[model samples]
Target: MTTKTSDSPLPWPPAAEQLPPHLRLMGIAAAKWVVQPVYVLAKLGAADHLAEEELSTAALADRLKVRCDPLRRCLRAAASVGIFRETEQDHWALTDTADHLRTDAQMSLRDFTVLLGEAPMWAPFGHIMDVMRQDTPAFDAVHGQPMYAHLAEDDELARTYHGAWSSLTEGVMRALTTAYDFSRFATIADLGGGDGTALRILLATHPQLRGILMDLSHSGEIHQGADRAFEERLRTVSGRLPDDVPPGADAYFLKNTLHCLSPDLVLQTLRRIRSEMTRPEQRLLIVEGVVQQGNGFDWSKLMDIEVMVNNGGREHSLEEWRTLLSQSGFRLTSAREVLHPQWLLEAEAA
Candidate 1:
């Protein structure tokens, strides 16, 4: 799962040079469109087919029930960005990127992209200017309700949103498990570990460790644990982070969960972890993309705007995380970049 830095990410355009400032201003909002083909590909089970062979456009069209020209156009667009590759002029093959879209990949981001480009997810971008003017969730302005509430009651929306979130997190989970040492802890509770995938890896890697996932009662509906080698060592508790965390657990993993919450919500969740920790060895492991504004436009910084539009959440810089961690009585002990935009951040009770 661990790759050299080259595989971690393409080092440049430097990331910023990928687009001009003005283009970025718009592309930042428009980039959700990039997730569309991924969703379509996943729905068509394109990767599943590619697992067997590179497909000719006609074969893909036959499998997907779409016309060849449309399928070819989509393949062309995806391949241009390296999401898929052309094995020959009219044939397409899956890339490493395809792994993330598979249902059973080590770290699947398939579900995540489904929600990213859906109307509700993309609708918020239209209100960013008003959000800047009014200082409110543009989502509420556009949808007449909060994003979560709207999705919570709508099965289809919830499914798509969670799918998109899962897609965004697939690589993160892969990058995190292979890049860190989790053997010292006997028990770890992922405060918002959706399907217990992280727990699955940790349990497999650390046989003595048993990991619990604490999330909403309905979390299983959207983020069910997979039947895997280490699944027996994993368990799920049906509740929110503040209520579901077990007392005296050795570690709490909050991966990408904080990026969608406001600072107050984050503080409250961190406080819950604090209340559960009394032993010196207890800790919190946060995997997120730290914002490095003015210096970089790495994906994380760009994602800050996406969060802002979608949830009113802002990406935190390393300093921001350090301050927040300390505020919750935790001290950051180490930091490592796990992927191109993500960092494996470790903190212990202060």
Candidate 2:
């Protein structure tokens, strides 16, 4: 007798949606409590241990050689945030998101998660006021040295840092290879190419192009499944950028490298590259997070704050890129969207 409608209000305000403003704010502020546990699990290889089957927290603790209670508590907290699942009390299993934290997982972010837990990296978030009030970088203020310099002095930290970057480059390389054409260039020189992954992808995708991977230190391990035929075509060179970038490459790919430096250094680097150009027809491909102007939000804007706190570097708008290129004696010819949040700003000598 009664016809039920598809859209009907069960209650004026659902019980779950009735959280008080302060409690909601508290949940937001308490995010670190959730993430820290996941970081611990990542650092302890818990995901890899759970990859095979669901296990009791006691089993995971035994494998990791830590106390059971604390580990169980951590797992429960992590489960609360969907990283892991608690099938029952004290029993846990990996979720889809948690599976990626496994060391052997493709495009694993475990190293990056570990780095996020490191004091030198996460400490900056607490000192934003200081970073804004003074010219001193938050990382420098907290750690007594710039982030890069600090990493240089500690081999372990440096390894973790580069490993994190390698993970990111690996994840983005597919998007990049598909978005832009490398066949037009005879040789592509990657500036600050960590682990040579990006260059390898480009080389494999475009057989016509050879690549030179340049970095401050040639430490990143070559890709596991690198094309055997293109092995001879790939080369790695080590040196500081803008100065040490291999000369005369048809196109220079500076992927996410400029955002790590100050504007002055970026300009100097651009000028140095400009001087190295053998022909006016050559291009300088600046691959970076070019912030979109206006009310919309983008990851680049958030990263700009992180860069500010860590190294005083700032992400730029397209107009800013155009200005920087023009000032460095190059003309911004084309800004190609290579994947979301990344752009390839192609420029020629002005």
Which has the greatest TM-score? 2
On residues 1-350, what C-alpha lDDT tens digit does candidate 2 reach at each position?
11111322322122237577677677766778887888889889998888877778778788999999989888888766667778756677777777778887787888888888987789888999997689888899898888877876887877777777676777677887777666678988888876776887777778898888887663445544666777778777777865776787999888888997889989999999998886866889888898987877688998899888898888999999999999999999889777678888889988
Worst 10 residues of 2 by lDDT: 1-10
Clash-forming residue pairs, model 2: none
Model 1's TM-score against the true structure: 0.77
Give the clash total for candidate 2: 0
The digit string of per-residue lDDT tens for model 1 on 1-350 reads 32211123432222557667776667555554555765677767777677667779899889878888877777776665567677656877767876666676666766665566567777787778988887678888899887666876788876666556555565566667678877788888887776555566566657899877877666654334456645566667777644456676788888877887878878888887888888888878988888776863488877888877777777898999999989999999998888878888999889
List CA RMSD, all candidates: 5.2, 6.4
Output the TM-score of candidate 2: 0.87
Q: Which parts of model 2 have CA positions greater than 4 angstroms off?
A: 1-20, 218-231, 294-297
Look at candidate 1 and tell me the lDDT of residue 112.
65
Off by over 4 Å in 1: 1-42, 50-58, 79-109, 154-179, 220-232, 241-244
